[model samples]
Target: MAEPTTRPRDAALGSGPGRVLLTVYLIFAVAAGARALVQIATKFGEAPLAYLLSAVAALVYIAATVGLAVGGARGRVIALTGCSIEMVGVLVVGTLTVTDAAAFPDDTVWSRYGSGYGYVPLVLPLIGLWWLWHNRPRDRA
Candidate 1:
């Protein structure tokens, strides 16, 4: 009979600190998606770019949450990509909104580096990337 392989301490991404990270991602997914939906439904013309960006942010958050919850090689890839995209999005959008407010004309979740949400939008991806690295898969040969 083959011996059972041991699971690493950091094997499960949804365990320990990962739970908190997952919760935050879920919350942001809901908040950004809902806000974007409402804005698009009522007054998309008011700030189409901002609303669309918020929707995109929400999708990224949702993907990250799912990746964390799933917790495997595939999950790691998904989470990594999502976090990378989110980090870039926040930086680009935040810079644009600050350097030229007229370009945005409205706030997305990442506006001013997420000043509206206490900058969680700005920092969450960094934390997520770290968490993903911490929980990376190990070879158990």
Candidate 2:
């Protein structure tokens, strides 16, 4: 039997595809967080649910970024969880906002499948999930 080769803990954070994914995740984290903050501070009463959803999305993005950058068993788990939640969020919010306008008076990060953000919000989580899966660490023999 052949022994499995494993990547170093710092490998994902160093460079290459992992680094690129991390960069993207960081961008989403920043953008989502900033937008959420502005919405909450300026006029939370206008659309509390949407603003809160944005904050949750931002936190998920941040977690995913950290997981990708960390590159380990724990990181994989965190990234997977975050990505899954993000996917669900985008879909649910997108559908609700479009089908029921009364509930969502304002836009959220996932509103209309991220139309406001050029759909980057919709695509980012999928890409992050794919990257994490692709860079998954090999099991030790």
Candidate 3:
């Protein structure tokens, strides 16, 4: 029997693209989490749903960052799940905000498809999912 081929260790961690993605995920996680914290602390009553959504988005970003950093089977699954949730959240929240503005007095990260964040919040998940899929480990036959 032949040993299964595996990716080089350096290729997994030191890849330029992976580093960039990790950095972006980290930044988003921190930003979203901090903003949610401030919102919840100062005025949770103002828009509870929106604030909670922000927190959720922050958490997903954090998970994505961890997944990318970990880079393995478990990590990929985590990242994939996060990305899927993110996509759904953005679409739902964005539509709600636009179609029923009265329901959302305050802005969440996904409000208006992340318009306030230059649509990065909207696009980030797609990018993350794509990256994860691209880098997914292939079984050696």
Candidate 4:
């Protein structure tokens, strides 16, 4: 008996460059989450705002990873929102960290355009949004 293997209409989201994107997102999620957890658990008082922003970045990366893995209409929407938020956060945080170093007092994943992480944080969302847009569902009329 042949078993039925259903193919997802949006499976493309997790293939090709999308796979690389997902891997990066997963790495960032783990990295940011771990860093934020350790900072918050240990020296939170030293940089509460930075630590909190790191935690938020972790959450956004996690959401984007899950959305890319899910690979469907809803997943696209989730990924879009996650990437959009990430882009804004990185830009705003990066600018603030550069213009007002005293206000930050500590580094986040998005600090200085993600200079701490090789600037991947600054470029990731742009790639993600482009991937999502490129793989968007077409009308099957």
Q: What TM-score does each of the candidates earn?
A: 0.91, 0.86, 0.90, 0.93
Any residue pairs clashing in model 4, and if so which? none
Deviation of model 4 at 87, angstroms = 0.3
Model 4 spans with C-alpha error above 4 angstroms:
1-9
Worst 10 residues of 1 by lDDT: 6-15
Alpha-carbon lDDT of model 2: 0.85
RMSD to the true structure for each prediction, in A, is 2.5, 4.4, 3.8, 1.6
Q: CA shift at 99, candidate 3, in angstroms?
A: 0.7
Which candidate should be chosen as best, given lDDT against the real structure? Answer: 4
lDDT score, residue 123, model 4?
94
Determine which window of 10 residues in candidate 3 has minimal summed lDDT: 6-15
Per-residue lDDT of candidate 1, residues 1-141 (tens digit): 999975444446435687889999999999999999999999999999999999999999999988877766777888899999999999999999999999898899999999999999989999999988877766789
How far residue 19's Cα lies from its native spot in candidate 1, in Å, is 0.5
Tens digit per residue, CA lDDT, model 4, 1-141: 999975465657436676789999999999999999999999999999999999999999999999888878888888999999999999999999999999998999999999999999999999999888777878889
Question: What's the C-alpha lDDT at position 42 in model 2?
Answer: 99
120 Cα displacement, candidate 2 (Å): 1.3
